[model samples]
Target chain A: MKYSWYRLDNSAIMYQMVLTPRAQSLFRMGVKLKSPVVPSALKCAVDKAFLRHPFFKSELKRGFFRPYLDENKLPFIIEEDDGVLLKLLDFSSNNRYLLRVSYFGNRFFIDYFHGLCDGTGALEFLKTVAFYYFDALGIPFPDKNILTLSSSPSEEETEDAFTKYYRKPELGKGINSMAGGQAFHVRGKNFSSTGYGLIQANVSTSALLDAAHRLNCSVTVFLTALILASVAEAHVKGVPKHNLTAFVPINLRKRFPSKTLGNFTVFAKIIIPKDCPLDFESLVPVVKKLLEEQLGEREVILKLGFTSLMSKMPLFKFMPLFIKGFISRIGRTLSTPKQTFILSNMGKIDIGENEVIDEFLFNLNCNKKTPDNVGVLSYGDKTLISFTRKIVSTEIERIFCKKLASLCGEVKVISNFREECNAL
Target chain B: MRCKNCNVEIACKSSVCPLCHKPLVSDGEVPFPTPATKKILMGKFSLAYLVIAVIANIVCITLNFVLTPKILWCVPVLVSFIYVYYFVSVTVLAKRGFHKRILGQALILTAIFAAIKLAIGGNHWIFISWLPAVYLVSDLLMLIFIFKKKNEASKYIATLLLLCIFGAIPCISAYVFDLSVKLPSIIATSVSAAIFIICLIVCRKTIIHELKKVFNL
Candidate 1:
């Protein structure tokens, strides 16, 4: 019998190459409902949602040249949430599914392996699952705009957007400017085990927007500037001064206009030199300007083209899988020191004015090199800015919260480290 | 609900601020549940096994030296200890696939037995009898696994193919070293080749598909 399979996307190849047992490229996006979750309803809803999205019913398989997604026929099992933020997804234990869906109390989370899909794609899946869940609960869903179980899977949803928009550049022409030398690395003792210390700061969406508007910048740029300044203030006194850079992932769908749910995002490296002003107000323009330079249409297209082109190079195409994986792992390690932290703003998730849902949560997994990362998602007046770190020190998060409180008036914080702190 | 030290609202119901670790003024609901503690005891248990194995090996060696310096009974004891530790840690306790653990155990045991034979300067029983028998058992186990989990044949076929390659190694080594007992090696190589041929004929499409997926050719 024939089976459905797909070539790993241009960006997913990198994720697969650098994937280790320790460094699981995982991230979570979840929703907290007003009432406790029903296990039977969630299981039924997940089954329906799994059938709806055929693209997500596959597993990553190692190929001779590169990894590919093979159709997985294993029964989809919805697990009870074990209270871990971004827990490792053991493929053998998870029946080879790259993504996991689990519920705890009123919240249900979908932790996705980056090789399967990026955050936007995973959000679409989450919304669909949540929509089916509410349906199973016999509750009315206010949002008809989101993808539901009734929607049919489309071929375009699985297309490689990076390859689709690849415009060959002129011969011998390359990017004029590149990200400069090594950014300052964050220092802290890692967690005792493989888990993240999560701190979610809930603030009003309008308040954050108002603060960003006052600085004449977007919310992402404003937050990036704040984080850079906070890192500088928190670590500069003790450590050697170095340039601070934040990697902000920009969704390519907005500019390229593709509905592909595959990995189709590029990052804009916003660097603040060691000598630059460390205050929030002065750093905004620098961030805004640098963001603009990297996010330009021509620059993004060039990057997309080059990335896709590199994957298609004869040397890369013919290299054996193990060799390619080794090379990519080395490449990732070498390039990791060039960035300080990752700041991913998932933008606003409009689930409509659904009375049953309380708020949305977005959490990112940090690696050993960059121990602290941020994930932001806004839903229904509440914008949750989450700090997921592998380290113990909260000095950077403390400074960031204090600065954010001064701007947003009030910031409500929640964390998974309450037990640890209480014991201490 | 608010933490004065951090100047932020304590959304969770913890007694102290998550950031500043200071007392909060009022109580609130915790948004996230406490994470389940990990199984760190398994790691400590493995370490304990290692310590015991080391002490046992040291005592056995010292006793062998004191009691019978002419004899080398401690060699087998050391090998047995090493195999026990490996079996407990990697085969029994490691978080890996069932097939991987079994295959790994088979390979390690074969190497250990071969090393013992060489260390003792024994006869060619290792190559003529022991090696062939181990290869046959491993090949049969892989075949059974493939047939039992036919739906997941793709996952097992690559390993089976690897076993076929390993099966040929003993035959080739026996010839290269010119061991007098060549009939067993010939019989083992023939059996392996015949099994491979049968697999190729019976599941030709699957074998080809698995190779294409594996090689991406």
Candidate 2:
């Protein structure tokens, strides 16, 4: 490995020592292939791809003060535990691999502990694995433009983008917009089992495309509006006339030029003022405008820089880890009320041209603080919306899917719920 | 295939939902990916600890030999080394089946400590007196914890009972060994036994419930 280890980036510190069973900080990306996935071919693909991205294969170790990643001799092995998806990872135990690859039928999914990488980095790794899987299947060479084990990893891919892109903060420009009243949280009976409830709503991409086009907005904005509307109806009950913000993670790799497979993402809040009559029609324009404004290079840079600068401070860096962990836990708790829910869109996954992959889906664990999360991803002609929640109620998902179905005239909702609890 | 119960599209070769384990009828949908092997290349933290410990012991032995071969101070070094190994293995490495592991650890520690005392020309009282007293206290605490139920009032009652018997060993040892400094042990045991009697009266119902849960009546 070129680098022994990098310090846990500012973006990842919030999740490091304060992890609970309820908040494992895990997310998954699954690929559904056209043909029955060959186990040997998949294994070969992983083994080959592992060489190119050895950073993901490294194990996390508890250092004297902070945690560091140590290189492991064994590659991250794939498990066939289809019984429970996104299972809790105990980093201290024998299973030190930060990543897990699981297979069911023609579906292959990689569950990543977020400390390893963000959605963008995880997606990039999975795309490469898919590329080699197709190659192992003796499929015709699709496209030459793809990341493979042959390509030597660059220093840029392993660079700490947060530190690299961090500019000295201007005195007056340091702004903290994390001021908001408590949100109307979604409450329900928790699952008897610790596993999250998943509702995978597969919408025709063309239908969603048309809806976004009509709204003069992107799919992400359109979906955010629908979610807000659904949450308002199903969970919030009544408008509290306060700031109900939806925290969206913007992948810095999109705006900045860094390919490190660690956390290089920052959050931007899209606030839906409680004063407004919350409706899909009105919220679409607001969400679109908010995203456009926050997605700017200058604003994101400042926000991310502020975080990076704080971590770089000598006083903050010198503080004992236990104290830092305590402060981080408190910060997380205080910040929870500001965000109504977390929505992450990996946008679209493209392995290569003429690939046999039929679809892709993304989902996240329901954290202790934020009990609900919606992950969006698209593959080919299908858009997979994974509504992962910790509670027994799927009212928000049902409402959101029903709204999308109303627009598209068809929507397929699949869930991991055992009981026909929430009747459609 | 789709699960009728969960309504989740099962990408499984089996005709059942992995989540709910409900039967599924094939709608001719393809399954998800399959892995090459179920076997994992497991990481060995314990093995790493063992290797480091072995290397350190070798270094200590070499230093002892270089200093003075006749004295062989490496013997105590070896005992201390083994104690460190037992500490890590019992506390850090093992996660499951703690009941057995903990008892095994207690036995090993007692044996190691007794051997050290004997080697240093201490009296047999180290084994007969000190070791048994410590073991008795630890074993009682362990049993209380092992029997304690989640969010139970009986745990507090058990704590009270443990406190009552706290000085029983010191007082008994003093009387049996015919020690002159028996005043401290007598006072401690009297106070403890008195408090224990008070708790047995005050927390009678809670103690009964705890006993029932522990004995599975």
Candidate 3:
């Protein structure tokens, strides 16, 4: 049967090509409510939200040239599975939803295939669902500031923003390129035997803000410096400290004026030299200075432009999916050791006038390469800093959280270690 | 109700907490409601497939009788139909499991090979030459489940051994049948054996662990 689909955009194509069984390109963005989530209410909320957002209603389909998102025919049911981190999306199954809604206790988590959308797109869908869910639960939500269900999906919402903003390739110029070098690799027993060791450390937003104020930097900058210091201290023998670079994703929406919900994000590397002292005071200034330099108009343009140029090239566009996938896999492996770890701070999301949402938590995927990742998000008074790792050693997470706890008094840490979800 | 262990509040009447699976006791209102059963479209697809297969088989049989009376071309058509039916019913229709699907594929391959041999009048060579090779490949796959630790090095060693066996069997059978494909078989066996020996030397520690697990020592 014929299905309506679109060519997988550049961001989406990379995810499809580089996915491995051991290292599925998957991440979880979650919401915790003040009260427990009602299953029927969540289903109702999902149904209403799905109608408003066209992206969530679609599934990935493998085409002759590349994979594309097709309209899903099966029921989009909310699952209650918590056995593994991000269960691979099986498109061949009767239900081919790219994103899965799973609930445990008061938490509702949405796991994405990375091909569907990025963190910003995911948060938009989650916010709408939370709005509808509270409304369905007899608790009315104010529509003034909340992202309520739209009557119709705007064409702009589903447009490929990369195509809209891509510029023609310049013949001769130095592209904004990150230096390739080995960084400190976190080594531990592979938790592939068990599942991913999930640890969420919740700190007071006010305390973090106060700490950031004292440091004269943003919360993300302060936290990134703290993480860098922790990793520097944990650095093993023989690894050069000069090569330590923390990979941070910079959302382009702040710079670019478009609401198109495909992947519109680029990465910046925070590099520190080996001779530099391993302390927060020493690293914070360097981080702030580098971030200022990296986020410059010229630098950001070149960084984003290079990716768009690659996708637009006829050579890459016409290459078979497997060949592209193979190249991407190799590229990821060679680049994986260049950075210490990936830290994504989705920033604050306002779940307006809804008393139900307690906080938002973000967690990155655990892969064979660069198995440990940190994700941060804040809502209301709580800022959840989550650590997702496939390694048995919690050294990095412990060091990072201990530093965070010192900065922000009384941090609450929770874990899913050795815990299994009860089957329904 | 709240889990004493995880400190997360539970909203179900079931004494066990859903998240950490710890026990809890307290009268708490059900959080939302149990989700309704999803309406899957598998039944509709199966019904349509069944209807198409039935009609096609009948039409093929009728065409065979009308087109050529002496040839009995319906035999091949019927064989293809059986293969499709077995694949759909065994693999697709049944509950999905990794081992179950592998077993189903093996059974289907065996049936297809047997049918082709019969259709070709006397190809005892298929059972002697190709079927064992296919079985050796499937057996390598089944070893994944049997060992439970799929990442172990010994499984790959067994896979390489089976690869060589796959090469050696065909060569031996070809010799018995006096066929002309001996040189290619020897090359396959030698290459597989060399790879296997290299892997054994490189991953000795991992292979030892795998062997211990297998022997239960």
DockQ of each: 0.51, 0.05, 0.03
Ranking according to TM-score, highest score first: 1, 2, 3
Best by the TM-score measure: 1
By DockQ, the best candidate is: 1
- Stretches of candidate 1 exceeding 4 Å from the true structure: A1-3, A169-179, A188-190, A237-240, A273-275, A418-424, B36-39, B42-73, B84-102, B173-181
Query: For each candidate, how many residue pairs have backbone atoms clashing (under 3 Å)?
Result: 2, 8, 3
User: Which prediction has more favorable lDDT, 1 or 3?
Assistant: 1
The complex in candidate 2 yields a DockQ of 0.05
Expressed as tens digits, the lDDT of each residue in A250-306 for candidate 1 is 899999888887899988888786677788888999999999998998778877877
Using DockQ as the measure, name the better of candidate 1 and candidate 2: 1
Interface C-alpha root-mean-square deviation, candidates in order: 2.6, 14.0, 14.6
Please give the lDDT score at residue B68 for candidate 1. Answer: 89
RMSD of 2: 17.9
lDDT (10s digit) by residue, model 2, range B15-134 = 545444457654544332221223344447557767887898899889877987666556666787677777676666666444445445555666665466555543545545554555
Between prediction 1 and prediction 3, which has the larger DockQ?
1
| Candidate whose lDDT is highest | 1
lDDT of 1 at A52: 76
Residue-level lDDT tens digits of model 2 in A1-424:
4654445666666667776655668899878787777888888888777777877767765443455565666545676744455778755442578788878766888888887789988887887888888888888655444667668877777666888888866546556443435665666777544456677788888889999998888999999999988888876656564566788888888787787878998878898767776888989989988888788777787787776864578787667667877887888766655677889988866655665777887988775456679999887778988888776666777677667877865676566542332311
Question: In model 3, what is the error at residue B123, expressed in angstroms?
Answer: 8.4
